[model samples]
Target: MIHTLSISELTVSRGERLLFQGLDLRIQAGEAVVLTGANGAGKTSLLRTIAGLLRPDAGEVAFHDGDGNPLDERLARGRETHFLGHQDGLKISRTAREELGFQCDWLGHVQCGMDDAVQAFGLAPLLDLEVRRLSAGQRRRLAMGRLVGSPRALWLLDEPMAPLDARWRAVFADQMRRHLDADGLILAAVHDPLPLPARTLDLGGLT
Candidate 1:
Protein backbone atom coordinates (compact mmCIF):
# COMPACT_ATOMS: atom_id res chain seq x y z
CA MET A 1 0.00 0.00 0.00
CA ILE A 2 1.07 3.57 -0.65
CA HIS A 3 -0.06 6.95 0.54
CA THR A 4 -2.07 7.58 -2.60
CA LEU A 5 -5.25 7.02 -4.54
CA SER A 6 -4.88 4.21 -7.04
CA ILE A 7 -7.42 3.27 -9.66
CA SER A 8 -6.58 0.14 -11.57
CA GLU A 9 -8.24 -0.99 -14.78
CA LEU A 10 -11.51 0.72 -13.92
CA THR A 11 -14.53 -0.01 -16.05
CA VAL A 12 -17.86 1.81 -15.93
CA SER A 13 -20.92 1.43 -18.09
CA ARG A 14 -24.30 3.15 -18.33
CA GLY A 15 -27.30 1.06 -19.28
CA GLU A 16 -25.25 -1.15 -21.61
CA ARG A 17 -23.33 1.75 -23.09
CA LEU A 18 -19.64 1.50 -22.39
CA LEU A 19 -18.54 5.01 -21.46
CA PHE A 20 -15.04 4.04 -20.44
CA GLN A 21 -13.01 0.91 -19.86
CA GLY A 22 -9.58 -0.18 -18.67
CA LEU A 23 -8.97 3.16 -17.04
CA ASP A 24 -6.08 3.55 -14.66
CA LEU A 25 -5.21 6.53 -12.51
CA ARG A 26 -2.94 7.45 -9.63
CA ILE A 27 -2.90 10.62 -7.53
CA GLN A 28 -0.90 11.51 -4.49
CA ALA A 29 -0.88 14.10 -1.75
CA GLY A 30 0.10 17.66 -2.67
CA GLU A 31 -0.95 17.14 -6.28
CA ALA A 32 -4.01 17.90 -8.39
CA VAL A 33 -5.44 15.88 -11.25
CA VAL A 34 -7.97 17.32 -13.70
CA LEU A 35 -10.39 15.22 -15.71
CA THR A 36 -11.12 16.56 -19.19
CA GLY A 37 -13.58 15.24 -21.73
CA ALA A 38 -16.52 16.15 -23.91
CA ASN A 39 -20.14 16.01 -22.84
CA GLY A 40 -21.35 12.47 -22.01
CA ALA A 41 -17.79 11.30 -21.72
CA GLY A 42 -18.21 9.74 -18.28
CA LYS A 43 -16.37 12.40 -16.31
CA THR A 44 -19.20 12.64 -13.82
CA SER A 45 -19.62 8.87 -13.72
CA LEU A 46 -15.96 8.36 -12.87
CA LEU A 47 -16.10 10.90 -10.08
CA ARG A 48 -19.27 9.28 -8.82
CA THR A 49 -17.56 5.93 -8.69
CA ILE A 50 -14.62 7.35 -6.81
CA ALA A 51 -17.02 8.94 -4.33
CA GLY A 52 -18.66 5.53 -3.66
CA LEU A 53 -22.01 6.79 -5.00
CA LEU A 54 -21.89 4.39 -7.93
CA ARG A 55 -20.35 0.95 -8.22
CA PRO A 56 -17.76 0.32 -10.85
CA ASP A 57 -18.30 -2.56 -13.22
CA ALA A 58 -14.70 -3.66 -12.71
CA GLY A 59 -11.36 -2.71 -11.14
CA GLU A 60 -10.20 -1.47 -7.78
CA VAL A 61 -10.12 1.92 -6.07
CA ALA A 62 -7.98 2.26 -3.02
CA PHE A 63 -7.04 5.05 -0.64
CA HIS A 64 -3.99 4.59 1.56
CA ASP A 65 -3.43 6.50 4.77
CA GLY A 66 -0.60 8.96 5.43
CA ASP A 67 1.52 6.07 6.62
CA GLY A 68 0.93 4.23 3.33
CA ASN A 69 -1.49 1.66 4.66
CA PRO A 70 -5.01 0.93 3.44
CA LEU A 71 -7.60 2.43 5.77
CA ASP A 72 -10.78 0.62 6.63
CA GLU A 73 -13.72 1.48 4.42
CA ARG A 74 -15.76 3.02 7.19
CA LEU A 75 -13.03 5.38 8.29
CA ALA A 76 -12.06 6.10 4.68
CA ARG A 77 -15.55 7.20 3.73
CA GLY A 78 -16.22 8.91 7.03
CA ARG A 79 -13.35 11.34 7.54
CA GLU A 80 -10.71 10.78 4.85
CA THR A 81 -12.58 12.04 1.81
CA HIS A 82 -15.02 14.66 0.51
CA PHE A 83 -17.09 14.53 -2.64
CA LEU A 84 -18.66 17.67 -4.10
CA GLY A 85 -20.90 16.73 -6.95
CA HIS A 86 -22.91 18.49 -9.66
CA GLN A 87 -25.89 19.12 -7.38
CA ASP A 88 -25.80 21.89 -4.81
CA GLY A 89 -25.95 19.23 -2.04
CA LEU A 90 -27.55 21.82 0.21
CA LYS A 91 -30.82 21.94 2.10
CA ILE A 92 -32.91 24.65 0.48
CA SER A 93 -34.61 25.59 3.74
CA ARG A 94 -31.32 25.97 5.58
CA THR A 95 -29.36 29.16 5.54
CA ALA A 96 -25.95 29.13 3.88
CA ARG A 97 -24.36 29.37 7.29
CA GLU A 98 -26.22 26.35 8.64
CA GLU A 99 -25.55 24.17 5.60
CA LEU A 100 -21.84 24.93 5.58
CA GLY A 101 -21.62 24.65 9.33
CA PHE A 102 -23.14 21.18 9.25
CA GLN A 103 -20.63 20.01 6.66
CA CYS A 104 -17.65 21.37 8.60
CA ASP A 105 -18.96 19.80 11.75
CA TRP A 106 -19.49 16.47 10.01
CA LEU A 107 -15.81 16.49 9.06
CA GLY A 108 -14.95 17.23 12.68
CA HIS A 109 -13.31 20.54 11.88
CA VAL A 110 -15.99 22.91 13.07
CA GLN A 111 -13.49 24.55 15.38
CA CYS A 112 -11.51 25.67 12.33
CA GLY A 113 -14.21 28.30 11.78
CA MET A 114 -16.00 29.08 8.54
CA ASP A 115 -14.71 32.61 8.18
CA ASP A 116 -11.93 31.69 5.77
CA ALA A 117 -14.31 29.52 3.77
CA VAL A 118 -16.86 32.36 3.58
CA GLN A 119 -14.24 34.84 2.47
CA ALA A 120 -12.87 32.40 -0.08
CA PHE A 121 -16.18 32.46 -1.91
CA GLY A 122 -17.37 35.91 -0.86
CA LEU A 123 -20.27 34.32 0.98
CA ALA A 124 -19.92 36.44 4.12
CA PRO A 125 -22.90 38.59 3.15
CA LEU A 126 -25.12 35.71 2.12
CA LEU A 127 -24.43 33.62 5.23
CA ASP A 128 -27.78 34.40 6.77
CA LEU A 129 -29.79 33.93 3.56
CA GLU A 130 -31.73 30.74 2.95
CA VAL A 131 -30.24 28.56 0.25
CA ARG A 132 -33.44 28.77 -1.79
CA ARG A 133 -33.24 32.53 -1.95
CA LEU A 134 -29.64 32.70 -3.05
CA SER A 135 -28.73 32.72 -6.73
CA ALA A 136 -27.40 29.50 -8.24
CA GLY A 137 -23.86 30.85 -8.16
CA GLN A 138 -24.28 31.90 -4.56
CA ARG A 139 -25.39 28.43 -3.57
CA ARG A 140 -22.42 27.00 -5.44
CA ARG A 141 -20.09 29.25 -3.51
CA LEU A 142 -21.50 28.00 -0.25
CA ALA A 143 -21.15 24.38 -1.27
CA MET A 144 -17.56 25.00 -2.30
CA GLY A 145 -16.98 26.42 1.16
CA ARG A 146 -17.36 22.96 2.65
CA LEU A 147 -14.15 21.96 0.92
CA VAL A 148 -12.17 24.71 2.56
CA GLY A 149 -13.77 24.56 5.98
CA SER A 150 -13.54 20.79 6.37
CA PRO A 151 -9.96 20.09 5.23
CA ARG A 152 -10.43 16.54 4.03
CA ALA A 153 -7.43 14.75 2.55
CA LEU A 154 -8.88 13.58 -0.75
CA TRP A 155 -11.45 15.66 -2.69
CA LEU A 156 -13.58 14.38 -5.57
CA LEU A 157 -15.12 17.33 -7.36
CA ASP A 158 -17.40 17.22 -10.41
CA GLU A 159 -17.50 20.47 -12.32
CA PRO A 160 -16.67 22.38 -9.15
CA MET A 161 -16.40 25.61 -11.11
CA ALA A 162 -19.58 25.25 -13.16
CA PRO A 163 -21.67 27.97 -11.53
CA LEU A 164 -18.85 30.39 -10.82
CA ASP A 165 -18.11 33.63 -12.67
CA ALA A 166 -14.71 34.84 -13.86
CA ARG A 167 -13.86 36.40 -10.50
CA TRP A 168 -15.01 33.37 -8.57
CA ARG A 169 -13.16 31.03 -10.89
CA ALA A 170 -9.92 32.67 -9.88
CA VAL A 171 -10.97 32.43 -6.29
CA PHE A 172 -11.76 28.75 -6.67
CA ALA A 173 -8.39 28.17 -8.32
CA ASP A 174 -6.63 29.83 -5.43
CA GLN A 175 -8.58 27.62 -3.04
CA MET A 176 -7.44 24.53 -4.93
CA ARG A 177 -3.91 25.83 -4.86
CA ARG A 178 -4.00 26.20 -1.11
CA HIS A 179 -5.49 22.76 -0.67
CA LEU A 180 -2.65 21.19 -2.62
CA ASP A 181 -0.02 23.23 -0.83
CA ALA A 182 -1.38 21.87 2.44
CA ASP A 183 -0.61 18.36 1.16
CA GLY A 184 -4.22 17.68 0.19
CA LEU A 185 -5.30 15.88 -2.98
CA ILE A 186 -7.82 16.92 -5.64
CA LEU A 187 -9.54 15.16 -8.55
CA ALA A 188 -11.55 17.74 -10.46
CA ALA A 189 -13.57 17.57 -13.69
CA VAL A 190 -13.39 20.84 -15.57
CA HIS A 191 -13.44 22.55 -18.95
CA ASP A 192 -11.76 25.80 -17.95
CA PRO A 193 -8.12 25.90 -17.04
CA LEU A 194 -7.13 25.19 -13.43
CA PRO A 195 -5.04 28.00 -11.99
CA LEU A 196 -2.42 25.62 -10.62
CA PRO A 197 -0.33 22.83 -12.01
CA ALA A 198 -2.52 19.80 -12.73
CA ARG A 199 -1.87 16.60 -14.62
CA THR A 200 -4.67 16.33 -17.20
CA LEU A 201 -6.55 13.07 -17.71
CA ASP A 202 -8.77 13.47 -20.71
CA LEU A 203 -11.48 10.83 -21.09
CA GLY A 204 -12.44 11.87 -24.59
CA GLY A 205 -10.37 9.05 -26.08
CA LEU A 206 -11.72 6.44 -23.72
CA THR A 207 -15.28 6.82 -24.95
Candidate 2:
Protein backbone atom coordinates (compact mmCIF):
# COMPACT_ATOMS: atom_id res chain seq x y z
CA MET A 1 0.00 0.00 0.00
CA ILE A 2 1.24 3.48 -0.81
CA HIS A 3 1.63 6.00 2.02
CA THR A 4 1.79 9.78 2.23
CA LEU A 5 3.41 11.96 4.87
CA SER A 6 1.76 15.17 5.91
CA ILE A 7 3.21 17.85 8.11
CA SER A 8 1.11 20.80 9.18
CA GLU A 9 1.88 24.04 10.95
CA LEU A 10 5.08 22.51 12.24
CA THR A 11 7.26 24.45 14.64
CA VAL A 12 10.65 23.21 15.81
CA SER A 13 13.49 24.45 17.99
CA ARG A 14 16.91 23.35 19.13
CA GLY A 15 17.58 24.16 22.77
CA GLU A 16 17.07 27.89 23.27
CA ARG A 17 17.35 28.55 19.56
CA LEU A 18 14.28 28.55 17.38
CA LEU A 19 14.46 26.57 14.16
CA PHE A 20 11.38 26.98 12.02
CA GLN A 21 7.70 27.69 12.69
CA GLY A 22 4.46 27.13 10.86
CA LEU A 23 6.07 24.83 8.34
CA ASP A 24 3.91 22.53 6.29
CA LEU A 25 4.67 19.83 3.73
CA ARG A 26 3.04 16.90 2.00
CA ILE A 27 5.07 14.08 0.46
CA GLN A 28 3.07 11.76 -1.74
CA ALA A 29 4.01 8.20 -2.53
CA GLY A 30 6.65 7.99 -5.33
CA GLU A 31 7.85 11.54 -4.62
CA ALA A 32 11.10 12.76 -3.12
CA VAL A 33 11.69 15.91 -1.10
CA VAL A 34 15.26 17.07 -0.62
CA LEU A 35 16.04 19.36 2.28
CA THR A 36 18.54 22.07 1.38
CA GLY A 37 19.98 24.60 3.80
CA ALA A 38 23.14 25.77 5.47
CA ASN A 39 24.36 24.01 8.57
CA GLY A 40 22.27 24.56 11.71
CA ALA A 41 19.29 25.49 9.57
CA GLY A 42 17.34 22.61 11.12
CA LYS A 43 17.35 20.34 8.07
CA THR A 44 18.28 17.34 10.15
CA SER A 45 15.87 18.39 12.88
CA LEU A 46 12.98 18.46 10.45
CA LEU A 47 13.75 14.98 9.17
CA ARG A 48 13.94 13.67 12.72
CA THR A 49 10.64 15.29 13.61
CA ILE A 50 8.97 13.65 10.63
CA ALA A 51 10.42 10.30 11.63
CA GLY A 52 8.93 10.73 15.12
CA LEU A 53 12.41 10.82 16.59
CA LEU A 54 12.08 14.34 18.04
CA ARG A 55 9.22 16.20 19.63
CA PRO A 56 8.35 19.23 17.56
CA ASP A 57 7.77 22.27 19.67
CA ALA A 58 4.49 22.57 17.83
CA GLY A 59 2.65 21.04 14.85
CA GLU A 60 1.54 17.62 13.73
CA VAL A 61 2.94 14.95 11.40
CA ALA A 62 0.58 12.32 10.08
CA PHE A 63 0.78 9.26 7.86
CA HIS A 64 -1.99 8.21 5.51
CA ASP A 65 -2.31 5.31 3.12
CA GLY A 66 -3.17 5.62 -0.58
CA ASP A 67 -6.86 5.56 0.29
CA GLY A 68 -6.28 8.57 2.57
CA ASN A 69 -6.90 6.49 5.68
CA PRO A 70 -4.70 7.28 8.63
CA LEU A 71 -2.39 4.49 9.61
CA ASP A 72 -2.11 3.19 13.14
CA GLU A 73 0.54 5.09 15.11
CA ARG A 74 2.47 1.92 15.77
CA LEU A 75 2.39 0.82 12.15
CA ALA A 76 3.61 4.23 10.98
CA ARG A 77 6.55 4.04 13.32
CA GLY A 78 7.43 0.45 12.66
CA ARG A 79 7.73 -1.25 9.28
CA GLU A 80 6.38 1.65 7.26
CA THR A 81 9.50 3.83 7.42
CA HIS A 82 13.29 3.67 7.46
CA PHE A 83 15.59 6.40 8.79
CA LEU A 84 19.26 6.67 7.85
CA GLY A 85 21.07 9.29 9.87
CA HIS A 86 24.65 10.62 9.85
CA GLN A 87 25.79 7.60 11.81
CA ASP A 88 25.98 4.31 9.95
CA GLY A 89 24.13 2.55 12.81
CA LEU A 90 26.29 -0.55 12.60
CA LYS A 91 28.11 -2.54 15.24
CA ILE A 92 31.84 -2.08 14.87
CA SER A 93 32.53 -5.43 16.42
CA ARG A 94 30.45 -7.38 13.93
CA THR A 95 31.31 -8.50 10.42
CA ALA A 96 29.66 -6.65 7.54
CA ARG A 97 27.72 -9.80 6.72
CA GLU A 98 26.44 -10.06 10.26
CA GLU A 99 25.36 -6.45 10.26
CA LEU A 100 23.37 -6.85 7.06
CA GLY A 101 21.92 -10.11 8.37
CA PHE A 102 20.66 -8.39 11.51
CA GLN A 103 19.18 -5.47 9.56
CA CYS A 104 17.43 -7.76 7.08
CA ASP A 105 15.80 -9.63 9.94
CA TRP A 106 14.77 -6.50 11.76
CA LEU A 107 13.30 -4.93 8.63
CA GLY A 108 10.65 -7.69 8.38
CA HIS A 109 12.55 -10.99 8.21
CA VAL A 110 13.35 -10.61 4.52
CA GLN A 111 16.77 -12.18 4.92
CA CYS A 112 16.66 -13.67 1.46
CA GLY A 113 17.48 -10.31 -0.11
CA MET A 114 20.70 -9.86 1.82
CA ASP A 115 22.87 -11.53 -0.78
CA ASP A 116 21.27 -9.60 -3.57
CA ALA A 117 21.85 -6.34 -1.76
CA VAL A 118 25.46 -7.25 -1.14
CA GLN A 119 25.93 -7.92 -4.82
CA ALA A 120 24.18 -4.71 -5.81
CA PHE A 121 26.40 -2.64 -3.56
CA GLY A 122 29.52 -4.55 -4.60
CA LEU A 123 29.88 -5.47 -0.95
CA ALA A 124 30.59 -9.17 -1.45
CA PRO A 125 34.31 -8.61 -0.94
CA LEU A 126 33.81 -6.80 2.34
CA LEU A 127 31.31 -9.19 3.90
CA ASP A 128 33.70 -11.10 6.13
CA LEU A 129 35.57 -8.03 7.34
CA GLU A 130 34.69 -6.51 10.70
CA VAL A 131 32.73 -3.30 10.25
CA ARG A 132 35.46 -1.35 12.03
CA ARG A 133 37.94 -2.53 9.46
CA LEU A 134 36.00 -1.13 6.54
CA SER A 135 36.65 2.31 5.13
CA ALA A 136 34.12 5.08 5.64
CA GLY A 137 32.74 4.62 2.14
CA GLN A 138 32.62 0.88 2.55
CA ARG A 139 30.75 1.21 5.83
CA ARG A 140 28.28 3.58 4.24
CA ARG A 141 27.68 1.10 1.42
CA LEU A 142 27.07 -1.61 3.97
CA ALA A 143 24.65 0.62 5.83
CA MET A 144 22.78 1.39 2.63
CA GLY A 145 22.43 -2.31 1.84
CA ARG A 146 19.47 -2.47 4.20
CA LEU A 147 17.49 -0.05 2.06
CA VAL A 148 17.49 -2.63 -0.71
CA GLY A 149 17.46 -5.76 1.43
CA SER A 150 14.35 -4.57 3.23
CA PRO A 151 11.86 -2.40 1.46
CA ARG A 152 9.85 0.27 3.23
CA ALA A 153 7.34 2.90 2.13
CA LEU A 154 9.25 5.98 3.28
CA TRP A 155 12.99 6.60 3.54
CA LEU A 156 14.43 9.46 5.63
CA LEU A 157 18.09 9.95 4.78
CA ASP A 158 20.73 12.44 5.92
CA GLU A 159 23.81 13.08 3.77
CA PRO A 160 23.39 9.66 2.19
CA MET A 161 26.13 10.34 -0.35
CA ALA A 162 28.65 11.96 1.95
CA PRO A 163 31.12 9.11 2.17
CA LEU A 164 30.84 7.61 -1.25
CA ASP A 165 33.13 7.96 -4.25
CA ALA A 166 31.87 9.37 -7.55
CA ARG A 167 31.13 5.89 -8.89
CA TRP A 168 29.04 4.70 -5.95
CA ARG A 169 27.42 8.07 -5.68
CA ALA A 170 26.11 7.64 -9.21
CA VAL A 171 25.12 4.09 -8.38
CA PHE A 172 23.06 5.18 -5.40
CA ALA A 173 21.53 7.94 -7.50
CA ASP A 174 20.07 5.32 -9.79
CA GLN A 175 18.89 3.35 -6.78
CA MET A 176 17.03 6.37 -5.41
CA ARG A 177 15.31 6.91 -8.72
CA ARG A 178 14.28 3.26 -8.82
CA HIS A 179 12.85 3.55 -5.32
CA LEU A 180 10.71 6.50 -6.32
CA ASP A 181 9.60 4.66 -9.42
CA ALA A 182 8.36 1.88 -7.18
CA ASP A 183 6.02 4.27 -5.33
CA GLY A 184 8.45 4.81 -2.47
CA LEU A 185 8.80 8.14 -0.68
CA ILE A 186 12.12 9.77 0.15
CA LEU A 187 12.91 12.78 2.34
CA ALA A 188 16.59 13.48 2.43
CA ALA A 189 18.83 16.21 3.89
CA VAL A 190 21.64 16.61 1.41
CA HIS A 191 24.48 18.99 0.61
CA ASP A 192 25.21 17.84 -2.92
CA PRO A 193 22.34 17.85 -5.35
CA LEU A 194 20.44 14.57 -5.74
CA PRO A 195 20.59 13.23 -9.30
CA LEU A 196 16.86 12.50 -9.56
CA PRO A 197 13.91 14.83 -9.83
CA ALA A 198 12.97 16.19 -6.42
CA ARG A 199 11.38 19.17 -4.80
CA THR A 200 13.82 21.21 -2.76
CA LEU A 201 12.73 22.70 0.55
CA ASP A 202 15.06 25.41 1.73
CA LEU A 203 14.91 26.09 5.48
CA GLY A 204 16.99 29.27 5.21
CA GLY A 205 13.99 31.53 5.28
CA LEU A 206 12.05 29.46 7.78
CA THR A 207 14.68 30.12 10.38
Candidate 3:
Protein backbone atom coordinates (compact mmCIF):
# COMPACT_ATOMS: atom_id res chain seq x y z
CA MET A 1 0.00 0.00 0.00
CA ILE A 2 2.74 2.40 -0.92
CA HIS A 3 2.46 5.36 -3.25
CA THR A 4 4.97 4.92 -6.02
CA LEU A 5 4.53 8.19 -7.90
CA SER A 6 2.99 11.59 -7.17
CA ILE A 7 2.52 14.43 -9.62
CA SER A 8 1.20 17.82 -8.62
CA GLU A 9 0.03 20.64 -10.83
CA LEU A 10 2.22 19.31 -13.62
CA THR A 11 2.42 21.61 -16.62
CA VAL A 12 4.39 20.46 -19.64
CA SER A 13 5.15 22.29 -22.86
CA ARG A 14 6.88 21.18 -26.02
CA GLY A 15 8.03 24.04 -28.20
CA GLU A 16 5.08 26.47 -28.39
CA ARG A 17 2.48 23.85 -27.59
CA LEU A 18 1.23 23.21 -24.08
CA LEU A 19 0.54 19.53 -23.67
CA PHE A 20 -1.27 19.68 -20.34
CA GLN A 21 -1.77 22.01 -17.39
CA GLY A 22 -2.47 21.40 -13.73
CA LEU A 23 -2.25 17.65 -14.12
CA ASP A 24 -2.30 15.82 -10.80
CA LEU A 25 -2.05 12.06 -10.49
CA ARG A 26 -0.96 9.44 -7.98
CA ILE A 27 -0.10 5.84 -8.71
CA GLN A 28 -0.10 3.35 -5.87
CA ALA A 29 1.69 0.04 -5.82
CA GLY A 30 -0.32 -2.79 -7.37
CA GLU A 31 -2.42 -0.51 -9.57
CA ALA A 32 -2.51 -0.43 -13.37
CA VAL A 33 -3.32 2.89 -14.98
CA VAL A 34 -4.00 3.10 -18.69
CA LEU A 35 -3.38 6.33 -20.56
CA THR A 36 -5.80 7.06 -23.41
CA GLY A 37 -5.58 9.92 -25.86
CA ALA A 38 -5.54 10.91 -29.48
CA ASN A 39 -2.33 11.21 -31.49
CA GLY A 40 -1.38 14.72 -30.36
CA ALA A 41 -2.67 14.62 -26.80
CA GLY A 42 0.75 14.23 -25.08
CA LYS A 43 0.38 10.77 -23.69
CA THR A 44 4.04 10.02 -24.31
CA SER A 45 5.06 13.33 -22.79
CA LEU A 46 3.18 12.54 -19.62
CA LEU A 47 4.84 9.16 -19.32
CA ARG A 48 8.23 10.72 -19.89
CA THR A 49 7.63 13.23 -17.12
CA ILE A 50 6.71 10.47 -14.67
CA ALA A 51 9.80 8.50 -15.52
CA GLY A 52 12.03 11.52 -14.77
CA LEU A 53 13.27 11.52 -18.36
CA LEU A 54 11.68 14.91 -19.04
CA ARG A 55 11.33 17.58 -16.42
CA PRO A 56 7.99 19.37 -16.53
CA ASP A 57 8.05 23.04 -17.34
CA ALA A 58 6.08 23.55 -14.15
CA GLY A 59 5.37 21.31 -11.13
CA GLU A 60 7.03 18.29 -9.63
CA VAL A 61 7.38 14.55 -10.17
CA ALA A 62 8.13 12.75 -6.93
CA PHE A 63 8.92 9.16 -6.08
CA HIS A 64 8.44 7.30 -2.79
CA ASP A 65 10.06 4.05 -1.78
CA GLY A 66 8.30 0.92 -0.58
CA ASP A 67 8.13 2.36 2.95
CA GLY A 68 6.15 5.37 1.64
CA ASN A 69 8.99 7.83 2.28
CA PRO A 70 10.59 9.93 -0.44
CA LEU A 71 13.68 8.42 -2.00
CA ASP A 72 17.06 9.93 -1.26
CA GLU A 73 18.14 12.79 -3.47
CA ARG A 74 21.16 10.88 -4.75
CA LEU A 75 19.25 7.75 -5.66
CA ALA A 76 19.08 7.00 -9.34
CA ARG A 77 15.57 7.14 -10.78
CA GLY A 78 16.38 4.30 -13.16
CA ARG A 79 16.72 1.99 -10.17
CA GLU A 80 13.08 2.41 -9.20
CA THR A 81 11.35 3.17 -12.48
CA HIS A 82 11.61 1.55 -15.88
CA PHE A 83 10.68 3.62 -18.94
CA LEU A 84 9.92 1.76 -22.15
CA GLY A 85 9.58 4.29 -24.91
CA HIS A 86 7.90 3.72 -28.30
CA GLN A 87 11.25 3.49 -30.05
CA ASP A 88 12.92 0.43 -28.59
CA GLY A 89 16.30 1.42 -27.18
CA LEU A 90 18.74 -0.97 -28.74
CA LYS A 91 22.22 -0.99 -30.18
CA ILE A 92 21.98 -1.91 -33.84
CA SER A 93 25.35 -3.58 -33.82
CA ARG A 94 24.78 -5.71 -30.74
CA THR A 95 23.16 -9.08 -30.96
CA ALA A 96 20.09 -9.85 -28.83
CA ARG A 97 22.10 -12.08 -26.47
CA GLU A 98 24.77 -9.46 -25.89
CA GLU A 99 22.26 -6.68 -25.26
CA LEU A 100 20.48 -8.69 -22.58
CA GLY A 101 23.73 -9.72 -20.95
CA PHE A 102 24.82 -6.09 -20.75
CA GLN A 103 21.54 -5.02 -19.21
CA CYS A 104 21.59 -7.77 -16.62
CA ASP A 105 25.10 -6.87 -15.63
CA TRP A 106 24.36 -3.14 -15.55
CA LEU A 107 21.33 -3.67 -13.33
CA GLY A 108 23.43 -5.85 -10.99
CA HIS A 109 20.75 -8.50 -10.77
CA VAL A 110 20.34 -11.94 -12.26
CA GLN A 111 16.69 -12.64 -11.39
CA CYS A 112 16.01 -13.12 -15.11
CA GLY A 113 18.55 -14.83 -17.32
CA MET A 114 19.09 -14.47 -21.04
CA ASP A 115 17.74 -17.94 -21.73
CA ASP A 116 14.51 -17.25 -19.83
CA ALA A 117 13.98 -13.92 -21.57
CA VAL A 118 14.75 -15.45 -24.96
CA GLN A 119 12.14 -18.15 -24.45
CA ALA A 120 9.59 -15.76 -22.99
CA PHE A 121 9.95 -13.31 -25.86
CA GLY A 122 10.34 -15.98 -28.51
CA LEU A 123 13.77 -14.58 -29.36
CA ALA A 124 15.64 -17.87 -29.10
CA PRO A 125 16.29 -18.20 -32.83
CA LEU A 126 17.16 -14.54 -33.19
CA LEU A 127 19.60 -14.48 -30.26
CA ASP A 128 22.63 -14.37 -32.51
CA LEU A 129 21.13 -11.87 -34.96
CA GLU A 130 21.94 -8.18 -34.77
CA VAL A 131 19.15 -5.98 -33.48
CA ARG A 132 18.95 -3.92 -36.68
CA ARG A 133 18.52 -7.09 -38.67
CA LEU A 134 15.45 -8.17 -36.69
CA SER A 135 11.89 -7.30 -37.65
CA ALA A 136 9.99 -4.56 -35.86
CA GLY A 137 7.89 -7.06 -33.89
CA GLN A 138 10.96 -9.00 -32.89
CA ARG A 139 12.76 -5.89 -31.72
CA ARG A 140 9.79 -4.83 -29.66
CA ARG A 141 9.68 -8.19 -27.96
CA LEU A 142 13.36 -7.88 -27.17
CA ALA A 143 12.83 -4.45 -25.67
CA MET A 144 9.95 -5.74 -23.58
CA GLY A 145 12.07 -8.62 -22.39
CA ARG A 146 14.73 -6.22 -21.21
CA LEU A 147 12.25 -4.09 -19.33
CA VAL A 148 10.70 -7.12 -17.67
CA GLY A 149 14.09 -8.22 -16.41
CA SER A 150 14.70 -4.98 -14.57
CA PRO A 151 13.90 -4.87 -10.86
CA ARG A 152 12.05 -1.56 -10.98
CA ALA A 153 8.95 -1.00 -8.91
CA LEU A 154 7.18 1.24 -11.41
CA TRP A 155 6.94 0.95 -15.19
CA LEU A 156 6.20 3.65 -17.75
CA LEU A 157 5.29 2.08 -21.05
CA ASP A 158 4.32 3.98 -24.17
CA GLU A 159 2.34 1.92 -26.68
CA PRO A 160 3.84 -1.33 -25.40
CA MET A 161 1.46 -3.38 -27.52
CA ALA A 162 2.10 -1.62 -30.81
CA PRO A 163 4.38 -4.14 -32.52
CA LEU A 164 3.13 -7.21 -30.68
CA ASP A 165 0.96 -9.85 -32.31
CA ALA A 166 -2.06 -11.41 -30.57
CA ARG A 167 -0.01 -14.20 -29.02
CA TRP A 168 2.69 -11.88 -27.73
CA ARG A 169 0.12 -9.39 -26.50
CA ALA A 170 -1.41 -12.10 -24.36
CA VAL A 171 1.99 -12.95 -22.96
CA PHE A 172 2.66 -9.31 -22.14
CA ALA A 173 -0.69 -8.98 -20.41
CA ASP A 174 0.07 -11.99 -18.27
CA GLN A 175 3.44 -10.54 -17.33
CA MET A 176 1.81 -7.22 -16.45
CA ARG A 177 -0.68 -8.94 -14.17
CA ARG A 178 2.11 -10.73 -12.38
CA HIS A 179 3.98 -7.50 -11.91
CA LEU A 180 0.93 -5.84 -10.40
CA ASP A 181 0.37 -8.75 -8.07
CA ALA A 182 3.90 -8.27 -6.74
CA ASP A 183 3.11 -4.65 -5.69
CA GLY A 184 4.51 -3.07 -8.83
CA LEU A 185 2.69 -0.27 -10.61
CA ILE A 186 2.26 0.28 -14.34
CA LEU A 187 1.22 3.31 -16.41
CA ALA A 188 1.00 2.56 -20.10
CA ALA A 189 -0.36 4.47 -23.08
CA VAL A 190 -2.29 2.01 -25.15
CA HIS A 191 -4.88 2.48 -27.90
CA ASP A 192 -6.30 -1.00 -27.76
CA PRO A 193 -8.28 -2.54 -24.93
CA LEU A 194 -6.19 -3.92 -22.04
CA PRO A 195 -6.71 -7.49 -20.99
CA LEU A 196 -6.40 -6.63 -17.27
CA PRO A 197 -8.29 -4.27 -15.00
CA ALA A 198 -6.97 -0.73 -15.18
CA ARG A 199 -8.12 2.82 -14.63
CA THR A 200 -8.20 4.96 -17.74
CA LEU A 201 -6.77 8.46 -17.80
CA ASP A 202 -7.71 10.42 -20.88
CA LEU A 203 -4.93 12.82 -21.82
CA GLY A 204 -7.14 14.29 -24.55
CA GLY A 205 -9.34 15.90 -21.90
CA LEU A 206 -6.36 17.70 -20.41
CA THR A 207 -5.55 19.25 -23.73
Best by lDDT: 2
Model 2 lDDT tens row, 29-129: 89999999889999999988988899999999999998999987567878878889999899999999999999888887464688768877999999999
Candidate 3 ranges with C-alpha deviation above 4 Å:
1-3, 73-76, 205-207
Candidate 1 to truth, TM: 0.93
Q: Residues 85-132, candidate 3, lDDT per residue (tens digit)?
A: 988878999998888777755755556555566777788888899998
Per-model C-alpha lDDT, please?
0.85, 0.90, 0.82
How do these models rank on TM-score, best leading?
Answer: 2, 1, 3
Worst 10 residues of 3 by lDDT: 72-81
Query: What is the Cα-based TM-score of model 3?
Result: 0.92
| Residue-wise C-alpha lDDT for candidate 1, range 31-60, written one tens digit per residue | 899999998899999988887878999998
The order of the candidates by lDDT, greatest first, is 2, 1, 3
What does the lDDT read for residue 137 in candidate 3?
89
Best-fitting candidate, measured by TM-score?
2
Query: What are the clashing pairs of model 2?
Result: none
Q: In model 1, which runs have C-alpha deviations exceeding 4 angstroms?
A: 205-207
Flag clash pairs in model 1. Answer: none
Q: Give me the overall lDDT of model 3.
A: 0.82
TM-score for every candidate vs. truth?
Answer: 0.93, 0.96, 0.92
